[model samples]
Target: MIGAGSTVIFHFDIKLSDGSAAESTRVHNKPAKLQMGDGSLSPAFEAELSGMQAGDKKTFTLEPQDAYGMPNPDNIYYVDRSKFSLDAPAQVGMIIGFAMPDGSELPGLVREVVGDSVTIDFNHPLAGQTLTFNVEIVQVIN
Candidate 1:
Protein backbone atom coordinates (compact mmCIF):
# COMPACT_ATOMS: atom_id res chain seq x y z
CA MET A 1 0.00 0.00 0.00
CA ILE A 2 1.05 3.57 -0.59
CA GLY A 3 1.25 6.08 2.21
CA ALA A 4 2.50 9.62 2.73
CA GLY A 5 6.17 10.02 1.70
CA SER A 6 6.11 6.81 -0.31
CA THR A 7 7.61 6.95 -3.78
CA VAL A 8 5.22 5.50 -6.29
CA ILE A 9 4.92 5.07 -10.03
CA PHE A 10 1.60 5.89 -11.63
CA HIS A 11 -0.10 6.63 -14.92
CA PHE A 12 -2.75 9.27 -15.19
CA ASP A 13 -5.13 10.92 -17.63
CA ILE A 14 -6.20 14.48 -17.03
CA LYS A 15 -9.42 15.73 -18.54
CA LEU A 16 -10.90 19.14 -18.73
CA SER A 17 -14.27 20.09 -17.38
CA ASP A 18 -15.70 19.70 -20.84
CA GLY A 19 -14.66 16.04 -20.91
CA SER A 20 -11.75 16.69 -23.22
CA ALA A 21 -8.47 14.99 -22.50
CA ALA A 22 -5.85 17.52 -21.53
CA GLU A 23 -2.93 15.19 -20.92
CA SER A 24 -2.15 11.54 -20.40
CA THR A 25 0.95 9.76 -19.26
CA ARG A 26 -0.34 6.49 -20.70
CA VAL A 27 -0.16 7.94 -24.20
CA HIS A 28 3.60 8.13 -23.86
CA ASN A 29 3.76 4.90 -21.88
CA LYS A 30 5.67 6.63 -19.14
CA PRO A 31 4.73 6.10 -15.55
CA ALA A 32 5.45 8.96 -13.20
CA LYS A 33 7.23 8.45 -9.90
CA LEU A 34 6.76 10.87 -7.09
CA GLN A 35 6.83 11.05 -3.32
CA MET A 36 3.55 11.67 -1.59
CA GLY A 37 3.18 14.88 0.44
CA ASP A 38 6.33 16.19 -1.20
CA GLY A 39 4.91 19.38 -2.71
CA SER A 40 5.06 17.86 -6.14
CA LEU A 41 1.30 18.20 -6.47
CA SER A 42 -1.31 20.46 -5.01
CA PRO A 43 -2.30 19.45 -1.49
CA ALA A 44 -5.88 18.80 -2.44
CA PHE A 45 -4.94 16.81 -5.50
CA GLU A 46 -2.44 14.68 -3.58
CA ALA A 47 -4.88 14.02 -0.78
CA GLU A 48 -6.89 11.79 -3.09
CA LEU A 49 -3.94 9.47 -3.62
CA SER A 50 -3.21 8.79 0.00
CA GLY A 51 -3.64 5.30 1.40
CA MET A 52 -3.84 3.49 -1.91
CA GLN A 53 -2.22 0.18 -2.77
CA ALA A 54 -0.45 -0.77 -5.94
CA GLY A 55 -2.69 -1.83 -8.84
CA ASP A 56 -5.37 0.55 -7.58
CA LYS A 57 -7.25 2.66 -10.07
CA LYS A 58 -9.19 5.73 -9.11
CA THR A 59 -10.93 8.68 -10.69
CA PHE A 60 -11.60 11.99 -9.04
CA THR A 61 -12.57 15.57 -9.77
CA LEU A 62 -10.94 18.72 -8.41
CA GLU A 63 -12.41 22.18 -8.31
CA PRO A 64 -10.57 25.16 -9.73
CA GLN A 65 -9.42 26.52 -6.38
CA ASP A 66 -7.94 23.16 -5.49
CA ALA A 67 -6.42 22.65 -8.91
CA TYR A 68 -5.20 25.82 -10.59
CA GLY A 69 -7.21 28.51 -8.89
CA MET A 70 -9.88 30.77 -10.45
CA PRO A 71 -9.16 32.95 -13.41
CA ASN A 72 -8.58 36.57 -12.59
CA PRO A 73 -9.96 39.36 -14.76
CA ASP A 74 -6.78 41.32 -14.20
CA ASN A 75 -4.94 38.74 -16.25
CA ILE A 76 -6.56 40.10 -19.37
CA TYR A 77 -4.54 42.69 -21.18
CA TYR A 78 -4.77 44.61 -24.43
CA VAL A 79 -1.77 45.02 -26.69
CA ASP A 80 -1.38 47.25 -29.69
CA ARG A 81 -2.06 45.41 -32.91
CA SER A 82 1.08 46.90 -34.35
CA LYS A 83 3.14 44.98 -31.84
CA PHE A 84 2.60 41.87 -33.88
CA SER A 85 4.40 41.41 -37.12
CA LEU A 86 2.38 42.54 -40.09
CA ASP A 87 2.83 39.09 -41.63
CA ALA A 88 1.58 37.35 -38.49
CA PRO A 89 -2.15 37.00 -38.53
CA ALA A 90 -3.95 37.37 -35.20
CA GLN A 91 -7.04 35.37 -34.46
CA VAL A 92 -9.21 34.41 -31.57
CA GLY A 93 -8.17 31.28 -29.64
CA MET A 94 -4.60 31.61 -30.76
CA ILE A 95 -2.03 31.04 -28.07
CA ILE A 96 0.77 33.59 -28.11
CA GLY A 97 3.84 33.17 -25.99
CA PHE A 98 5.18 36.29 -24.37
CA ALA A 99 8.57 36.75 -22.77
CA MET A 100 8.37 37.91 -19.20
CA PRO A 101 10.79 40.39 -17.68
CA ASP A 102 12.58 37.44 -16.13
CA GLY A 103 13.08 35.87 -19.57
CA SER A 104 10.55 33.10 -19.05
CA GLU A 105 7.88 32.48 -21.64
CA LEU A 106 4.25 32.92 -20.60
CA PRO A 107 1.49 31.77 -22.89
CA GLY A 108 -1.54 33.94 -23.42
CA LEU A 109 -4.62 33.33 -25.51
CA VAL A 110 -5.88 35.85 -27.99
CA ARG A 111 -9.39 36.67 -26.91
CA GLU A 112 -10.31 39.29 -29.51
CA VAL A 113 -8.95 41.62 -32.13
CA VAL A 114 -10.12 45.17 -32.58
CA GLY A 115 -9.10 47.90 -34.95
CA ASP A 116 -5.85 48.73 -33.19
CA SER A 117 -5.76 46.46 -30.18
CA VAL A 118 -5.61 42.76 -29.46
CA THR A 119 -6.99 41.39 -26.22
CA ILE A 120 -5.08 38.58 -24.58
CA ASP A 121 -5.99 36.50 -21.56
CA PHE A 122 -3.03 35.36 -19.51
CA ASN A 123 -5.03 33.09 -17.24
CA HIS A 124 -4.51 29.36 -17.62
CA PRO A 125 -7.14 27.86 -19.92
CA LEU A 126 -8.05 25.37 -17.22
CA ALA A 127 -8.58 28.05 -14.63
CA GLY A 128 -11.99 28.48 -13.05
CA GLN A 129 -13.09 24.94 -13.91
CA THR A 130 -12.96 21.53 -12.34
CA LEU A 131 -10.58 18.91 -13.67
CA THR A 132 -10.93 15.15 -13.73
CA PHE A 133 -8.15 12.67 -13.40
CA ASN A 134 -8.21 8.93 -14.04
CA VAL A 135 -5.22 7.43 -12.32
CA GLU A 136 -3.73 3.97 -11.85
CA ILE A 137 -1.02 3.25 -9.37
CA VAL A 138 1.41 1.01 -11.20
CA GLN A 139 3.95 0.43 -8.45
CA VAL A 140 4.91 1.49 -4.99
CA ILE A 141 8.69 2.03 -4.79
CA ASN A 142 9.06 2.65 -1.08
Candidate 2:
Protein backbone atom coordinates (compact mmCIF):
# COMPACT_ATOMS: atom_id res chain seq x y z
CA MET A 1 0.00 0.00 0.00
CA ILE A 2 1.10 3.57 -0.56
CA GLY A 3 1.62 6.14 2.17
CA ALA A 4 3.34 9.44 2.66
CA GLY A 5 6.86 9.57 1.18
CA SER A 6 6.34 6.47 -0.90
CA THR A 7 7.65 6.43 -4.48
CA VAL A 8 5.16 5.00 -6.91
CA ILE A 9 4.73 4.31 -10.63
CA PHE A 10 1.26 4.31 -12.07
CA HIS A 11 -0.57 4.59 -15.38
CA PHE A 12 -3.51 6.91 -15.62
CA ASP A 13 -6.05 8.15 -18.15
CA ILE A 14 -7.94 11.40 -17.81
CA LYS A 15 -11.25 11.89 -19.55
CA LEU A 16 -13.57 14.82 -19.83
CA SER A 17 -17.20 14.81 -18.87
CA ASP A 18 -18.18 14.23 -22.47
CA GLY A 19 -16.09 11.01 -22.54
CA SER A 20 -13.25 12.51 -24.53
CA ALA A 21 -9.83 11.28 -23.49
CA ALA A 22 -7.82 14.32 -22.54
CA GLU A 23 -4.61 12.52 -21.62
CA SER A 24 -3.25 9.08 -20.93
CA THR A 25 0.11 7.77 -19.85
CA ARG A 26 -0.75 4.33 -21.11
CA VAL A 27 -1.10 5.68 -24.61
CA HIS A 28 2.51 6.79 -24.42
CA ASN A 29 3.54 3.37 -23.12
CA LYS A 30 4.99 4.83 -19.94
CA PRO A 31 4.11 5.13 -16.30
CA ALA A 32 4.48 8.20 -14.14
CA LYS A 33 6.61 8.02 -11.01
CA LEU A 34 6.06 10.41 -8.18
CA GLN A 35 6.75 10.84 -4.49
CA MET A 36 3.73 11.17 -2.34
CA GLY A 37 3.03 14.55 -0.76
CA ASP A 38 5.60 16.19 -2.98
CA GLY A 39 3.26 18.80 -4.44
CA SER A 40 3.49 17.21 -7.89
CA LEU A 41 -0.13 16.16 -7.70
CA SER A 42 -3.02 18.12 -6.36
CA PRO A 43 -3.89 17.37 -2.74
CA ALA A 44 -7.42 16.42 -3.70
CA PHE A 45 -6.22 14.10 -6.47
CA GLU A 46 -3.49 12.64 -4.33
CA ALA A 47 -5.88 11.96 -1.50
CA GLU A 48 -7.57 9.43 -3.73
CA LEU A 49 -4.33 7.46 -3.99
CA SER A 50 -3.80 7.19 -0.27
CA GLY A 51 -3.89 3.67 1.12
CA MET A 52 -3.96 2.15 -2.36
CA GLN A 53 -1.92 -0.98 -2.77
CA ALA A 54 0.04 -2.13 -5.76
CA GLY A 55 -1.99 -3.79 -8.51
CA ASP A 56 -5.04 -1.81 -7.53
CA LYS A 57 -7.11 -0.28 -10.29
CA LYS A 58 -9.35 2.61 -9.46
CA THR A 59 -11.60 5.09 -11.24
CA PHE A 60 -12.98 8.34 -9.92
CA THR A 61 -14.52 11.60 -11.04
CA LEU A 62 -13.77 15.12 -9.86
CA GLU A 63 -15.61 18.38 -10.19
CA PRO A 64 -14.10 21.41 -11.87
CA GLN A 65 -13.13 23.10 -8.59
CA ASP A 66 -11.44 19.91 -7.40
CA ALA A 67 -9.66 19.33 -10.69
CA TYR A 68 -8.53 22.33 -12.78
CA GLY A 69 -11.00 24.92 -11.43
CA MET A 70 -13.78 26.61 -13.33
CA PRO A 71 -13.02 28.68 -16.40
CA ASN A 72 -12.95 32.45 -16.00
CA PRO A 73 -14.54 34.68 -18.61
CA ASP A 74 -11.71 37.13 -18.19
CA ASN A 75 -9.38 34.62 -19.77
CA ILE A 76 -11.02 35.22 -23.12
CA TYR A 77 -9.60 38.07 -25.17
CA TYR A 78 -9.62 39.55 -28.64
CA VAL A 79 -6.42 40.02 -30.58
CA ASP A 80 -5.68 42.12 -33.63
CA ARG A 81 -5.44 40.07 -36.81
CA SER A 82 -2.29 41.94 -37.77
CA LYS A 83 -0.49 40.16 -34.98
CA PHE A 84 -0.72 36.98 -37.06
CA SER A 85 1.08 36.48 -40.31
CA LEU A 86 -1.07 37.21 -43.31
CA ASP A 87 -0.16 33.80 -44.74
CA ALA A 88 -1.34 32.06 -41.57
CA PRO A 89 -4.92 30.92 -41.71
CA ALA A 90 -7.22 31.95 -38.88
CA GLN A 91 -10.15 29.72 -38.10
CA VAL A 92 -12.44 29.01 -35.20
CA GLY A 93 -11.61 25.99 -33.01
CA MET A 94 -7.95 26.23 -33.83
CA ILE A 95 -5.46 26.08 -31.00
CA ILE A 96 -2.63 28.58 -31.22
CA GLY A 97 0.37 28.71 -28.92
CA PHE A 98 1.44 32.08 -27.66
CA ALA A 99 4.53 33.01 -25.68
CA MET A 100 3.85 34.50 -22.30
CA PRO A 101 5.79 37.38 -20.75
CA ASP A 102 7.47 34.81 -18.52
CA GLY A 103 8.72 32.88 -21.59
CA SER A 104 6.23 30.13 -21.13
CA GLU A 105 4.11 28.91 -24.04
CA LEU A 106 0.38 29.10 -23.44
CA PRO A 107 -2.17 27.63 -25.83
CA GLY A 108 -5.27 29.56 -26.69
CA LEU A 109 -8.32 28.35 -28.57
CA VAL A 110 -9.68 30.50 -31.35
CA ARG A 111 -13.35 31.10 -30.80
CA GLU A 112 -14.04 33.69 -33.46
CA VAL A 113 -12.27 34.78 -36.63
CA VAL A 114 -13.53 38.19 -37.58
CA GLY A 115 -12.25 40.34 -40.41
CA ASP A 116 -9.46 41.96 -38.44
CA SER A 117 -9.88 40.46 -34.99
CA VAL A 118 -9.68 37.05 -33.42
CA THR A 119 -11.22 35.96 -30.14
CA ILE A 120 -9.14 33.53 -28.12
CA ASP A 121 -9.57 31.87 -24.76
CA PHE A 122 -6.58 30.93 -22.63
CA ASN A 123 -8.47 28.77 -20.19
CA HIS A 124 -7.95 25.03 -20.39
CA PRO A 125 -10.53 23.33 -22.53
CA LEU A 126 -11.33 20.96 -19.70
CA ALA A 127 -11.93 23.73 -17.24
CA GLY A 128 -15.44 23.99 -15.77
CA GLN A 129 -16.22 20.35 -16.48
CA THR A 130 -16.11 17.23 -14.36
CA LEU A 131 -13.25 14.84 -15.11
CA THR A 132 -12.87 11.11 -14.76
CA PHE A 133 -9.58 9.36 -14.09
CA ASN A 134 -8.74 5.70 -14.56
CA VAL A 135 -5.66 4.69 -12.64
CA GLU A 136 -3.72 1.50 -12.19
CA ILE A 137 -1.13 1.20 -9.45
CA VAL A 138 1.82 -0.55 -11.07
CA GLN A 139 4.43 -0.13 -8.36
CA VAL A 140 4.90 1.22 -4.85
CA ILE A 141 8.16 1.84 -3.04
CA ASN A 142 8.30 2.79 0.61
Best-performing candidate as measured by TM-score: 2
Best prediction by lDDT: 2
lDDT by residue (tens digit), candidate 1, 1-142: 7877889899999899789999899898998889988886788878888888799999999999888789999999999988999788778999999999999999999999989899999998888888998999999866
| Cα-lDDT of candidate 2 | 0.91
Taking every candidate in turn, the Cα RMSD to the unseen true structure, in Å, is 2.4, 2.2
Off by over 4 Å in 1: 1-8, 31-40, 139-142
Candidate 1 collision pairs: none
Error of model 2, residue 104, in angstroms? 2.4
**TM-scores of the models, in the order given:** 0.80, 0.83
What is the per-residue lDDT of model 2 for residues 40-96, given as tens digits with 9 covering 90 to 100? 776778889999989999999988887888999999999998888868777899899
